[model samples]
Target: MRVRLASTDDSPAVAEIYAPYVQTTVISFETTPPDAGQMAERIAATMPAHPWLLAEEAGTVLGYAYAHPFASRAAYAWSAETSVYVRPDRHRRGVGRSLYEVLLRLLAAQGYREAFAGVTLPNAASVALHEGMGFAAVGTYRRVGFKHGSWHDVGWWQRGLGGQGAPAAVRTVTDLEPSELARLLALPGERR
Candidate 1:
């Protein structure tokens, strides 16, 4: 599969890949599946500050990953919360891994200092993926989210992006030239 930056036009496919997780599982807390238009708006709003990436094979999107502000406070600007979703049929095929590797690299290139991921409890696959990518489990919020008539715990993991010492000015994805972004995404080898 090839990994590339996501465009607003990919929203419909992304939304379709995400709908099952929202409708049939506690992986996402969103009660209703977002439509393509909503996904397009989200892609537009997030692209300026963060990277949204997709993994595709034969022109079909297999999975996607992205990062967003970890918190609204200015002090939290160097950190981001991340999420990834793959088409159900594409599970265990490295689609999620490929997407995340590219996404994290782009985030690091854009000056993000840390990346965080939250996995709903009991999701061994997701937990393994994050840990395999070098994230350490930081903590868990017990029974924090209610879904499907039950409560679910969420485990948070963090990975440092090598940013340290005095803080540098963080650059948005929009600030990078197209060539630079493409180079970052095309880096070879799996992260782990």
Candidate 2:
């Protein structure tokens, strides 16, 4: 597999990949899956501020991962909330890992100090993925969201990104050098 930056044109594939989770599972609380147009808008809005990476092989997108500011407050600028979604058929194939490896590196390079991920309770696959990626258990929000006829808990995980020190201003994805971004996506961890 190979990891690369995600573009607006990849929205249809992204929407397709996320649809199952929305329609059939409580993994995502969204009741209605966004179509290609809405997905494109999401990419356009978030990519300007954070990295959105896609993992593919032989021109087929296997998965994608991305990050956005953890919160709008100034103090939260150095922290990001992250998410990843894979083609259901691509599970256990390292596609999610590849996408995350690139996404985390890009976030750190852009000055993020931490990354956070939230998994719906009882999702062993997602918990395993987050732990395997070096995130530690923080705390769980009990009965946080009501969806699919029940209230579901969400477990949050955290991983430090940049070095310990006062963080400089975070840079947007558009500010990153193309060569640097390309180099990060080529990391060994991003290669299957």
Candidate 3:
């Protein structure tokens, strides 16, 4: 599989992978599946400050991962919240891991100091994935979301990106030159 920065053109495929989670599961809290156009707008907005990465094999997108602003406050500029979604057929194939590995690396390169992920309770696979990637369980919000006729707990995990001392001004992924961005995505260990 190959990992790369996602483009607006990949929105439909990404949306397809995500629609099921929204429609059939509490994995995502979004009540309605976003259309391709909405996904495109989201990609455009988030790509300015963070990365939206896709894992593909034979030209088909298998999964995607991305980071977004953790909070609106300026004090939170060095942190980000992350999410990943994989095609249902592609589960257990390392698609999520591959996408997240690249996503974390890209976030670090973009100057993000920490990355956080929230997993809806009872999701063993997602919890394992985050822990395997070095995230520490921070806390859980009990019955934080009501979905699918039930209340769900949300567990939070955090991973430090090795930034130390006073943070330098954070740079958005878009602030990098095209070649630099390409090189970071193409880094030797980034793909599965």
Alpha-carbon lDDT, every model: 0.89, 0.88, 0.89
Angstrom error of the Cα, residue 169, model 2: value is 0.7
lDDT of 3 at 160: 97
lDDT of 2: 0.88
lDDT of 2 at 148: 86
TM-score of each model, in listed order: 0.95, 0.95, 0.94
lDDT of 1: 0.89
lDDT of model 3 at position 141: 99
Off by over 4 Å in 1: 187-192
Worst 10 residues of 3 by lDDT: 183-192
Query: Can you write out model 1's per-residue Cα lDDT over 1-192, one digit (the tens) per residue?
Result: 789888999999999999999999999999999999999999988886887888998999999999888999999999999999999898998888888888888888888999999999999999999998989999999999999999999999999988778778889887888888777777475231
Worst 10 residues of 1 by lDDT: 183-192
How many clashes show up per model?
Answer: 0, 0, 0
Q: For model 2, how does the per-residue alpha-carbon lDDT over 59-161 read when each residue is reduced to its tens digit?
A: 8988889897789988998999999999888899888887788888888888899999999999998899899999999999999999989999999999999
The segments of candidate 3 whose C-alpha lies over 4 angstroms from its true place after superposition are 177-179, 187-192
